[model samples]
Target chain A: MKRLSRLALAAALMLALAVPVSAQVSDGVVKIGVLNDMSGVYSDLCGPGSVEAVKMAVEDFGGKVLGKPIEVVSADHQNKADIGANVANKWIDVDKVDVIVDLPNTAVCLAVQKICQDKNRINLISTGASVILTNKNCSPTGFHWTYDNYALGKGTGTAMVKEGGDTWFFLTADYAFGHDLEKSTAEAVTKSGGTVKGSVRHPFPCNDFSSFLLQAQASKAKVIGLANAGGDTINAVKQAAEFGIVQAGQRLAGLLVFISDIHSLGLKTAQGLVVTTGFYWDQNDETRAWSKKWSARMNGRMPTMAQAGCYSATMHYLKAVQAAGSDEAKAVAKKMREIPVNDFFAKNGKVREDGRMVHDMLLAQVKKPEDSKYAWDYYKILRVIPGDEAYKPISETECPYLLEKK
Target chain B: MFELIGIPPQALFGQMLLGLINGAFYAVLSLGLALIFGLLNVINFTHGAQYMLGAYVAWLLLNFLGINYWLALVLAPVVVGAFGILLERLMLRKLYHLDHLYGLLLTFGLALIIEGVFRNLYGISGQSYPVPPVLTGGYNLGFMFLPLYRGWVVFVSLVVCLGTWLVIEKTKLGSYLRAGTENPTLVQAFGINVPRMITLTYGFGVGLAALAGVLAAPIYQVKPTMGADMIIVVFAVVVIGGMGSIMGSVVTGFMLGLLEGLTKVFYPEASNTVIFVVMAVVLLIKPAGLFGKAS
Candidate 1:
C-alpha cells in the first residue's frame, strides 16, 4: 500500500513538470498587447485600427518567431492612469505578453511606462506626444515611436516661421501634454527669430474655444499655434474658422495634427491648415498599398500616422526578436536599436539609445475642397524634413538613462 | 490697445458671448430636467442620452430622407418625444411607486444602454452637421465676430425657455401640472387622467431636451458622448436652481454660464470647475437650493 502511494505521487509531479514544458515548446506563443484608448475620444486615431495594423505586421513578418506563434491581444485603457496600470500588470503577468504598443494618451502612457519598467517589458509608444516620455521618465524598455510634441512643434513651428509668420499666439490645452507642446513650440518659434505675442491655456476636452480664439485674434499674432490633439484640435480649428481668424490673415498651425482630425473637420473647413505628420497614406506607392490593405480591414477608414507607426514598430520588434533568437525584453530592445527600421511606414528609421525612434516627418497642408480629387485625399506635402532635422537633438536630451551613462 | 484688466476687451467679450451661448444650452437642458423632476420625482438620468438621440435623429433625417434643418427642428423632438412616451409607459411607469432612488438607478441603466448602442453603431468620433446655409456667416460686432448660427441658438433658446415658462406659469394646462405636482391624489380625485398627464409631461420634458440637442448639433460635433459631458454640468445647474419654479432653471442656467465665461477670462484654469465649486458652496449654505422650497 505504501509503494502504491509513492507511485501515485510521482505521477502527479510528472504532470506538473509536463505542463510548462509543452507551453514553452509545442506552442511557444509570443503575445503582443495593444493597450490604448479603444472606446474614447482618441479611438479614431489608434483604437481598433491600430490593432489591425499590428496584426498585419505579424502576418507580413510570417507570423512566427523562432518557431513560436505570434498572437495579438488588446485592452482599452479608458484614458485612465490607474486602469492602464492594471491592464499593463495583467498583460505582463497573467497573459505573458512580451510587448505593449499604441498607447495614445500621455497620462496612460506614463502609467504604463512605470509598469513596463517594473516588468522589463518593451513598450512601443506610437501615439503619445509628451516629451517627458523620452526625457525625465525614460526607461530602458520604453521606445517613443512615431512623433513626440517636440518633433511636431519643430516641424510645424519652423515651417510657419520661415513663411514669414513671425508673430505667434498659442491656444494651449491645460494638461501635461499641452504644457510640453506649448513649451517646445515656443522654443522653436523663438529659435526661428519669431516673437510670441501672447498665449492662453484652455481646459482639455473643452467644448468651446470661441473666447480663446478671440484672444488669439486680439493678440494680432501672425500665427495661432494650436498645441493640442484629437478633438481639442478639431474643435479649436473649426471655431477658429467660424470666428474668421484664418480669413483675417492669421495662420492656424496644428502642432500635432492627425489624418483623423482632418477627416473629422472635412477638407472645406480644414483647408489651408499647415500641419506635420510622420506618415501620409498617399505619400508613396508603398504607403498607398499598405494603407489599402489597412483600410479594407478598417471599414474604409485610412490609417492615421499613429496606426501606421504601430505596424512599423511591431514589425521591427518582431524582426529584432528573431535576430536576437529570444523573446527576452532587454535582448529584443537592444537588437531594436541596433537594426534600422525599414517598413512601409518608416524607411531607414533608427531607434536612438534614448529609445526615440528617429524618422523623416512631412510638412503638409490640407487640400482645398476643389483641389481634392478623391475621398481621403487631404494632404498636399509641402516638404520632407529628414529624420535628423525633425527630432530633438540627442545632446539636448534629459533622459536619466542616457545622462547616467554619460 | 483696448484692454480690460490687462486683457483685450475682444477676448473678454468673446468669452462672455461664448459663455452666454453655453448658458443658453444649460438653461434649456436644465429646464427639461426640472420639469421632469417636478412632475415625476425622478432625476431623469437618461436626459443626456435622450439629448444625444435628438442629434442622431436630426442627422439621420438630413442624410437619409433629405430633411432640412427647419423640418428637423420640429421633427426630431417629436420622434424622440414619442420614444420617451413609449419608455415612460413600458418601463418608467413600473417604477413610479418605488423609491425615487430606484427610478434614478433604472434611468441611469437606461442611459448606459442607450449610449452603448450608439457607440456600437457609430464609434466615438463625432459626425459633423453643417450650419444651415441661411445662418452660415457671422456679422462683425467690432469687438468680436458673432456667428449668425450662434445668435440664432441664443435667440431660439430664450424664446423656448420663456415659452415653456409662460405655458407652465400662466395657462390652464399649466395649472393641472402644478396641481398634480403638489398633490397627485387630490388631482386624481378631481376627475383628471393623472397617469396620462404624467406620461405626457415626461414626453414634453424629453422633447425639450431633444430641441436643445438639435440646436447644439451644428455648434458641437454630433457624437454619442457629447450629451454625456454636458448633462453632468446641467445637473449642477439644476441643483443650484433648486427645481423650485420653471423660470428658476432658465435664470440660473444663463447666469451660471455667464459666470463660467467670466471665470475663463479671469482665471482660465478654473473655468471647468467653477460651476461645481459654486454647487458645493450652494449645498453648504443653502441645502434647499437657491430656488428650492424647504421640504
Candidate 2:
C-alpha cells in the first residue's frame, strides 16, 4: 500500500512538470489588451491601427499559442494618465490580460507601465517617445518595443549636424514629451560637436506657432528642431514654410515626425525635411510584403512605425510564451530578451536587459512632390542609422531591471 | 539698434505684426457672435463649426470644382450661410421660446455632432490648402518676411470687420434689424417680418464666421478640430466685449490680440492665457465691458 501511494505521487509530479505552460496560463485563454489613444489626436497613428496590427499578428501566429486561443481587446485612454491607469487595472485584475501594448501618450505610458509591473503583466511600449520609461521607471515586465525620443533625436541631430547644420534652435511644446525630445536632441547635438543656440517652449496642441517661429527665425540658428508632434508639429512646419524660414537659409529638422504627419503636410510643404524613424513600410521586399497586407487592412493607409511595433512586439511576446511554455510575466519577458527579433520590422534586433528593443533606425528625407513615384512614397531613405549608435547606450540605462541584474 | 526689455526692435515688431494678424481672426469671429447675440439673443456656439465648414468648403471647391481662391472666398460664405438659414429655420426656430441654456446646449451638441461627422469621414491629420498662386511669395518688411497670403488676410479681414460693423451700426437695414431685436412684436405690427429678419440675421452671423474661415484656410490646417480650438477664445472675446456690443467686440478683439502679442514677446508662456486673464479682470471690474452699455 505504501509503494502504491509513492507511485501515484511520482505520476502527479511528472504530469505537473510536463505541461506547466498551459497550466500556468491564468485563465483558459491568453488575452492581449491594446490600450492607447483611440479617439484623440494620436488615434490615427496608434489607435485602431494598433489593435488591427495585434489582431493580424495573432492570426499570423496560427490563432493559438500553447493550445490556448489568443484574444485581443482595446480601449481608449482619452489621452489622460489616470484614465489609462484605471483601464490597465481593470484589464489586468478583471480581464486577465497577459500583455498590454501600444501606449502612445507619454504620461499614460508612464502610468500604465507601473500598473503592469505591480500586477505582473507584460507591458509592450510601441509609441510614447519619452526616454524616462527605460531610464527611471522601467519594470521587469515592461519592454519598450519601438523607438524612443532619444534614438530619434540623436539620429536626426547627428545627420543634420553632419550636413552643416551645426547650430540648432528648438521650438518645443511645453510638456514632458516635448522636453524629453529637446533634451535628448540637445545632448546629441553637443555630443556630435554642435551647439544649441536656444530653445522656446510653446503651449501643447498650439495651433499658432508664429510666435515661436519668429523667435527661432530671430535666433538665426542653422536648423530649427521641432520638438513637438501631431498637429503641433504640422502647424509649426507649415508656418515655417509660410515665413520662408527655409528659403531664408535655415533648415527644419522634424526630430520625431511620423508618416501620418507627412501625409497631412503633403510633399509640397514637407519636401526636404529630414527626420528619423524606426521602420518604413517601403524599405525592402519583406517590409513591402508585410506593409501591403497591413495597409490593405488599414484601408490603403500605410502603417506607421508605431502600428508596426504592435505586430512585432505582440508576435515576439507570443513566441516567448510559446517557448517558455508559460504565460508567467517574468518568464515570458526573459524569453523575449533571450530571442533576437528577426521580422519585417527588425532584423536581428535585440531587447536589452533594460527593456529597450534596440533596432537600426532609418534616417530619411521627405521626397519632393515630383520625386514621389507612387502612393505613400513620401520618404527617400538618406541613410541607415546603426542600432548601436541610434539607441541609448546600455551603460547609460537606469532601468532597475538591469541595475539589479548587474 | 533700439531694444525693448532686451529684445531687438526688429523681433519685437515682428512679433507684434504676427499678433495683429491673429487679432484679425478674433475681430471677425467676435463680430459675428456679437451680431447674433445683439439681435437674436441666441448664443451661437455653432459659430466655430460654421467657421470650420467655411474652410472645408473652400478646400472642396478648390480641390473638387477647380474653383480658385477669390471665387471660393465669395461662394463658401454664401453656401455656408444658406446652410445656416436652414439650421435656423428647422432647428433654432423651435428653441427661441426656451431658456438661453437650451439654445446653448443645443448648439453645443450640434457643434460636437458636426465635428464628429467630419472626423469620422476624414480622420484627423487635416488637409492643407496651398497659398494661392497670386500670393505665392512674401514681402520682406525688414522686421519680418510677411507672406503675401497672410498680409492679404490682415488687410482684407480688417476691412470686412469694419465694413460689417458699419453696415450694422449705420445703414437703414441695420436700423430695422436693431429695432426688430428691441421690440420684435411691435416691429411685426409695423409690417416687417421679424421671424424672417431674425433667421436672416442668424444666417448672416454664421456667414461672417465662414468668411473668417476662408481667410484662415491657407494659413491654418483645415481640420475638424480647428473650430474647436478657436471657439472658446472667440466666446471669451464676445464675453469681454459684452454679449451684444458690436463695435466693442471689434475694438476689444484687436486690442487683446496686440496685448497677447506683447505678452508673447515678454513672457511667451502666458500668451495663450493673456486674453482670458484680461477677460477675468474685465468681468470683475467693468462687467458691462469697455464698449457695452450698462443694464
Candidate 3:
C-alpha cells in the first residue's frame, strides 16, 4: 500500500510539469479587446471599423494563435478616460484578455496604458496621437502602432513650410492631446524655418469656430495650422472657408486629418488642404486591393489609418505569438520587437525600444473637385516621408527604459 | 481705437461681431424654449433634438430631392415642426397634466432616442452643407471680413425674433393664447378653443428651433449632436433671460453670446464655461432671473 501511494504521487507531479508545453496560453483562449470612441466624434475613424479590422486579422491568421482559439471583443469608451480604464480593468483581470488595442482618445489611451502595464497585459495603441505614450509613459508591453503627434506635426509642418506657408497662425483645441499636438507642430514649424505668428485656443468639441477663425484671419499669417482633430477640425475648416480665410490667400493646414474628415467636408471645402497621413487607401496596388476588400465589408467606406493600423498591428502580433509559441504578454511583446513588421499598412516597419513602431507616412494635398476622378478619391500624394523622417529619432526619446540603461 | 487689455481694437471689434453672430444662435434657440415653457409648460428637453432634425431634414432635401438652400430653409421647419406636433399629440400631451419633472423626463428620453436613431442612421462624423453662391462672399470690414452668410444669419434671426415678439405681444390671438394658458377653464368658458391654441403654440415654438437649425447648417457640420451641444447653453440663456419671457430670452441670448465671444479673446480657456458663470451669478443674486417676473 505504501509503494502504490508513492507511485501515484510521482505520476501526478510529472503530469503538472508537462501540461505547460501543450497549453502555453493561460486561459486556453487568446482574447483581444478593442476599446475606442464607438459613438463620439472619432467613431467613424476608429470605432466599429477598428473592431472589424482586428477580427479580419484574426480570421486571416486562421483564427488561432499558438494552437489556441483567438477571440475578439470590443466596447465603446464613449471618449471618457474613466470608462476606458474600467473596461480595460475588467478586460484584463476578469476576462484574461491577452492584449488591448485601438484606444483613440488621448486621456483614455494613457489611462488604459497604465492599467495594462500594471496587469501585465499588452497594450497596442493604434489610434491615440500623444507622443507622451512613447516618451514619458512607455511600457515594455505597450506599442504605439500607427502614428503619433510628432509624426503628424513634423510631416505636415515641413511640407507646408516648403510650400511657402512659412508664417503660421494656429487654431488650437484646449486639452492635453491638443496642447501636445500644438507643441509638436510648433516645434516642427520652427525647425523647418516657419515662424508661428500667433495662436488662439478653442474649447474641445466646439461647434462654432467663428470666434477663433476671426482671430486667425486677423493675425494675417500666411498659413493657419489647425492643431485640432475630428469634429473640431471639421468645424474649423468649414468656418474658415466661410470667413474666406483660404480665398484671401492664407493656406490652412489640417494637422491631423482622416479620410473620414475629407469625406465629411466634401471636395469643394476641403480641396487643397495639406494633410499628413500614415495610410491612404488608394495609395498602391497592395493598399488599394486590401482597402477594396476591407471597404466592401465597410459599406464602401475606406479604412482610416487607425483602422488599418489595427489590422496591421493585430496581424504582426499574431505572427509574433505564433513564432514565440505562447500568448504570454512579455514573451509576445519581446517577439514582436524582434520580428520586422511587413504588411500592407506598414512596409519594413521596425518597433524601437521606446515601443514606437516606426513606419512610413504620406504627405498629401486634398484633391480638387475636378481632380477627383472617382468615388473616395481624395488625396494627391505629395511625397512619401520615410519612416525615420516621419517618426521621432531614438536619440530624442525620454522613455524610462533608455534612461535607466543610461 | 484703444485696445481692451492687450487685444487690439480691431481684434476686439471682430470678436464682438463674431460673438453677436453666435449670440444670434443662442437668441433663436432660447426664444423657442421660452415660447414653449411660457404656454405649454412642457420644458421641452427635445428642443435641441428638434433643432438637429431641422438640419437633417434640410440636408436630406438637398441631397435626395436636389432642393436648394432657400426652399429648404422654408420647408424644413414645417416638416420638423410637423414632427413636433406628432410628439405632442402622441406622447407629450399625456404628461402635460403631470409634474414638470414628468414632462422633462419624457422629453429627455425622447431626445436620447431621437439622437440615437440619427446616430445609427449616420455614423456621427457628420455631413457637410455648402454655402449658397449668394452667401459665399464676404464684405471686407477693415477689422474683419464678415461673411455674407453670417450677415444673413443675424438679419434672419432679428426678423424671426421680432415677428414672434409682435405676434405674441401685440395680436388679439396672442392675448387669447396667453389667457388660455393662464386659466384654461375660464378661457374655454369664454367660447375659445384653448386646446388648439396651445397645440399650435407648441408647434410654432418647435418650428422656431428648426428654423435656427436651418440657419446653422452651413456654418456647422450638420450632425446629430449639434443640437445637443447648443441646447445646454441655450437653456442657461433661457434661465438667465427669464424662462417664459420671449424678449428676455432673445436679449440674454445675444448678450451671453457677446460675453462668451469676449471671453474667447481675453481668456479663451474659460469661454465655454463663462456663460455658466454668469448664470450662477444671476441665480445667486436674483433667483427669478434678470428679466423674470415674480411668479
What fraction of the native interface does candidate 2 get right in terms of contacts?
0.63
Docking class of 1: medium
Q: What are the models' TM-scores? A: 0.95, 0.97, 0.97
In the range A142-168, model 2's lDDT, one tens digit per residue, is 999889999999999999999899999
* Model 1: colliding residue pairs: none
- How do these models rank on DockQ, best leading? 3, 2, 1
Question: A109 in model 3: Cα distance from truth in Å?
Answer: 1.4
Question: lDDT scores for all predictions?
Answer: 0.90, 0.91, 0.91
Cα lDDT tens digits for candidate 1, A1-406? 9999999999999999877555442237889999998888899899999999999999998988889999999999999999999999998888888899999888999999989988888999999988889888898989999999888998899999999998999999998889899999999999999999989999988888887787788788999999888888988888888777888899999998889888888887899999999999999999999999999998889999999999999999999988977777888899999999888788899999989999999999999999999989999999999999999888988999799889
Model 1 segments more than 4 A misplaced: A1-27, B1-4, B8-10
Candidate 2 Cα outliers beyond 4 Å, as residue runs:
A1-22
- By TM-score, rank the candidates, best first: 3, 2, 1
| lDDT sort, best first | 3, 2, 1
What is the per-residue lDDT of model 1 for residues B1-295, given as tens digits with 9 covering 90 to 100? 8678887766777788889998999999999999999999989999999999999999899989999899999999999999999999999999999999999999999999999899878877677788889998899997789999999999999999999999998999999999999999999999998999999999998998999999988888888888898899999999998964577789999999999989888888888999999999998998867888879
TM-scores of chain A across the candidates, in order, are: 0.93, 0.95, 0.95
Give the winner by DockQ: 2 or 3: 3
Model 3 chain A: worst 10 consecutive residues (lDDT sum): A18-27
- For candidate 3, what's the RMSD? 2.0
Error of 3 at B274 (Å): 1.0
